[model samples]
Target: MAATSLSLQIDARWRAATTPPDRPCGMEDIETASSSVVIVRGKEADGSGFWVTPSIVMTNNHVVDHNPDLKVGKDFPATVLATDSVRDIALLSVPNVYPEPVPLRGIEEMPRLADDLYVIGHPIGRNLTVSKGIVSALTNDDYDDRQYIQTDAAISSGSSGGPVVDRCGRVVGMATQTLRGAENVGYAIAWSQLSSHMDRMLKVVEGSSPEERELTYPSDQTEVVAKYYSTLGAGELAEAYDFYSASRKARLPYESWAQGLGKTVFIRLVSVTPGDKSNSVKVHFYSTEEVNAETWEWRTGEFEGTWTLTREGGLWKMNESNIKDITKPTTSP
Candidate 1:
C-alpha cells in the first residue's frame, strides 16, 4: 500500500506516528502495521524485521551477518544491504517488499522509563503473536554514547530483530535479545540510538552478494562435519545439540529433535565437498539404524546432502541441512 493510503496520520516525512495519549493500544492502526512486519529466515538467521523503505527492511546484525539466501516470511526473497555490529542492527534489500515502511521518527520524545511497550511479530515463526511490556529502564551504553531499552517483553529466539512498537504501533525500538536466566527481561536498541545510524548505513555501501564476496569458513569444516553425525550416532545427544546454530535451535525444539533421532544407531561420514557457497558444504554419509519401533534389526542407507554452517563462538555449527537418501534397501552403512 502507498504511504498516502495509510489511515494513521504522521508528520509529512513519515518519521513518527502521532497517536494521542487517550487512544487505546489495540486499534486499527496496529493491525494495519502488522502487515508491514515480516518473518525473516536465512541459513544462519531466523528472526523478524520491518520495512524501513519500500524495499529496505530493518533487522538485527546477528540475524543476517552473512548475506546468504534470505526469505521474508514466505512471500519475498531478501538480501542484506548493511549491518551495524555495534548497534546490532541490519538493513536488507527486499525487492518489491510488501506493505509499507514503518515510521522512522526523531527521538525528541523518547520512550520514558515505565512507559508501555508492545511487539507484534511471529516469534516462533508460526502465527503473529502479541507481547505487552513496560520500559523497565534505559541503560546507557559506552559504545556509541547511546541508551538501550530494557523491557519486560517476551523477545525470544525468532523475535530477535523484530520491531518494538508503541501503543500506536509506531517503531520505538528494535528487539535485540532477552536477558539469559531472567524472566521476560528483553533488551532493544532504543530509537534514540538507532535513527541516525540506520540512515548512515544506508548511505555508505550496498551489501555484497555471494558472487561478489569470496566467503570462507573461519576454520576447516571437515572435522566439524564429521564429528556432528558421529556424535549423534554415538547417542551423545547433549553434545550433538550444541552443534546447531541459534536459529536452527529456535526452529526445532530439543524434545522433538531428540525424539526423532532416538532410533539412530550409527552414522559414518563418507565424503565432504565444498558447496557453491563458501559458507556451505556438500556432505555424504551412511546411517545404520533400528529397522522399526518394534524391531532391533539394523539397516543402513547411503545419503548425500548439503549443509550450511556458520562460525558461532569460534566453532562451526550446523545452520541448515538438506540431505537425501540415495540408497536402495541393499545399501550399506
Candidate 2:
C-alpha cells in the first residue's frame, strides 16, 4: 500500500514566544503558549520537530541520532536546544529568551488506554499541524518499569519529538515510534519516563557554567585505532569509537569502539542508546553501499556493535569498541 503523505502549515502565532509578562495569569494566558513549538533541522538527516519549555526544548533521540556535529546553546548553528537519547528525548534552550516554560502534565494526570489524545508537529516539512486520535493501548514492551502510550494519531517521520496532549490540551507524553504494517498505530514515551530522566539531563546541561559543558571526543591515539575500522568501510564504527568514554575504551577496546556500527556500515544512523552524563552513546548505523546484486553485507553483521565515550575537557570522546554478529533467518534457495 502507498504510504500516506502529511503536510504542516506554518503559523506565525505558533512560533516560540519571546516575551511573557510577569503577573497573575489565567487560562487565556496559557492558551497563547502555542509559540513554544519549533522546527529542528539536522544537516545530515531529515528535519524533525520539537516543542519548548522555559529552560529547555524537547525532541526525539532518533532525530539527532546521526549528526554528531549537532549541539545546543545560543551559538548552535542548528535550531535544536539540547538532546537526550537514553529516553529517546532531547531538550533545546531557545535562542531568544522566553518568559514562561511549557507546562508538563504529571504522570498521575496522564490518560488511560483508549482515551482521547492530540499531537502537534510540523509533519512532512510543512508547518505547525495538529492531529487527533485515541490512546490505543498501554504496554511495557520497549523498556522495563516504563509504560508506552499507544495512540492512533498520524505520527510520521518529521513528527518525532512533538507533544502528545490529552483531552484538555495538556502534554501527556512525547511522540516516539510507530508500527510499519499498521494504520494510525503510533507510540509515545510516557511522561513517567521523561520525569525519570529529565532531572539528570538538566543537571548535565545546566549544572555547570555554560562554558564548562561541552561535548567530548576520543584522543588522537584512539583515532588511530578507530581508523583501522574505518578502513574496513566501518564509518559508523569509526565515528562510534571517536565518541567512546575513557573507562569503556580502556576496558573493552574493540567492542566498545565498534558498538556504534550499523548493518551496512553506512554513516546513516538507525538507532542509538544515549548514555547518561558519565556514559557513552550506543549508535547503530546502516551502510548505503550494496554488497552484491542480491544480498547486502552490513558493517558488523545483522546486529550493531557497542562503543563507549567519556568527557575530556568538556568534550565527549571515544574510549573503546567491539563488533558482534547478528543472525538472520535463512531463505530457501
lDDT by candidate, in order shown: 0.70, 0.53
TM-score of 1: 0.56
In candidate 2, what are the lDDT values of residues 1-333, reduced to their tens digit?
000110111123423222333654444432443354555666564434344344346778667655545533223444333344335666554433445444433333557777877776767656776788898888774433556799999998777877776654456788887899998999888876775565555544443333232332112222222333333453545554544456665676767435533234343334555444345444544345445635654222344566565556555455655545453666699
10 residues in a row with least lDDT, candidate 1? 1-10
- Measured against the true structure, the TM-scores of the candidates, in listed sequence, are 0.56, 0.62
Highest TM-score scorer: 2
Error of 2 at 316 (Å): 5.2
User: Which regions in candidate 1 have their CA more than 4 angstroms from the true location?
Assistant: 1-12, 16-26, 98-108, 206-333
lDDT of 1: 0.70
Error of 2 at 332 (Å): 9.9
lDDT of 1 at 163: 83
Candidate 2 TM-score, true structure as reference: 0.62
Query: Model 1: which residue pairs collide?
Result: none
Find the 10 residues in a row with the least total lDDT in model 2: 1-10
